[model samples]
Target: MKVADFHYERPDSLAKALVLLSRDDADVQALAGGQSLMPMMNFRLAQPDTLVDLNALEELRGIREAANHIEIGAMTRYAMLEASDLVRKHIPLFSIALPHIAHSAIRNRGTIGGSAALADPAAEMPALLIALNATITAVSTSGERKIAAKDFFLGLYETALDEGELIKSISVPKALIENRFGFYELTRRHGDYAMAGVAIAAQHMAPLTGLRIVFFGVSDRPLDVTAIAETLEGQSATDTDIVEAACRAIGNQSLHGDLNADAATKTHLAQVVLRRALRGMNA
Candidate 1:
């Protein structure tokens, strides 16, 4: 089906893009990789009056390691992150999760910021950000602001971005620099959205100091089980303890029953995956 006609604008600078998006009548849609948006547009799911292409904006592309955090430009593609040795060394979660995102062809063009802004519950980037406690920076004509990943994602396919506001970059804090990270997802086939997904980052202190567990494809947004982390405190994360925490996290979750598995089966799978992730971390 052919989508309704729309005008596309490739602004060379952030200031120009902001001005175009700021207009109330513009009905602007920000274009990044166009991996997700293009399909939706083709299916008529989106009917924007104007497209603000950020491809030419030099401000939106690169990876930088700061004193206390890793800064990734909004338009940096998944392929770039996957290929960057720096990202693999510093933020291994990105490397671990990137391979599971769609396919290589999609990854070649899919931007990290675009994926995060799209806010797909099953996407790897969002889950990783949650597990890593990263912060997102957004900009608009008015000003720029920073938002914690926890606060940024409001619900399914939703973010805290307001009208005219575009994601500028993401800041992943380096507090747990040597933390063990694990990302695993169960999908019907390669590149398909996961039926059940898990992202975990835990510091292996003698007492088990910090643990972050996030699950997607089981809720409107990536579910963070901070309470479970608290429950596992001072306890060595044995298989039994991991199983208990996984069970608690998935006990009453709202996972959809799809062709891959039923809700009951998914709950069981969640426990298994969680245990696997914890064991991977422990190893």
Candidate 2:
């Protein structure tokens, strides 16, 4: 079915977009690449009265390197991130996960902010951000607020974004530039959403300490298993401790059943992916 009739507005500036969103009658939806939104609209799942297209607002579309972090514009496309030297050099986990987002055509049009706002539990970007401890900045009439990845996602298909707020920028820490990273997922096919997955970014030390293991497609939001890091510290990831800790870490999470897999199946796959990720990072 076609989407219900709607009005489209392309604002020249973000301030204008905010003004448009502030009106109660407007029901404006921010349009970035329209990869996810368009399909929903076509299926009659989403019918916004006004679509506030942000593409013409050039200010929200590039990448910058700060002294301590890499600031990526929210509107930057997945394809751009896949080929970005800065992203490869700094946020390697992000680069690793980019290929898992739908397909080339979708990646070419899907923006980072769009994916984050969509908050699909199986999507790679959200899990990668949580694994890297990234922070997102939101702009609205109430002023700007910085939200950590852990607090950014609220639940399935939901986030902390308030009305009239647009994700302006995301700041990713530069400290993990040289970190050893591994991303693994079990999808029915390539480009399909993960049935269960893991993104691991760990600091390679003499004894191999400072690890961050994050799980997706297994919970309400991205699950960061920092306790797994502590358990793996000062020990070889090849050891049995890593495997046991990985299992225990995931066992604590209350996974939900879905069309892709049941909760029990996901819990098993989560263990397998976790072990695979830890080995990949160590190897």
Model 1 gets an lDDT of 0.84
Could you tell me which residue pairs clash in candidate 1?
A: none
lDDT of 1 at 114: 97
Once model 2 is optimally superposed onto the true structure by TM-score, how far is the C-alpha of residue 191 displaced, in angstroms?
A: 0.7
Which regions in candidate 1 have their CA more than 4 angstroms from the true location? 175-177, 258-260
Measured over all alpha carbons after superposition, the RMSD of each candidate to the real structure, in angstroms, is 1.7, 1.7
Worst 10 residues of 1 by lDDT: 201-210
lDDT of 2 at 274: 79
lDDT of 2 by residue, 1-283 (tens): 7778899999999899888877776678998899889889999898999998988887888989999899988899889888889888888778777888899999998999888888988788898888788899999977899999888988888999998888998889875534778889989999988888998777764466777778898887887777876866877556356667877877887887698789999898988887777677667
Model 2 local distance difference test score: 0.84
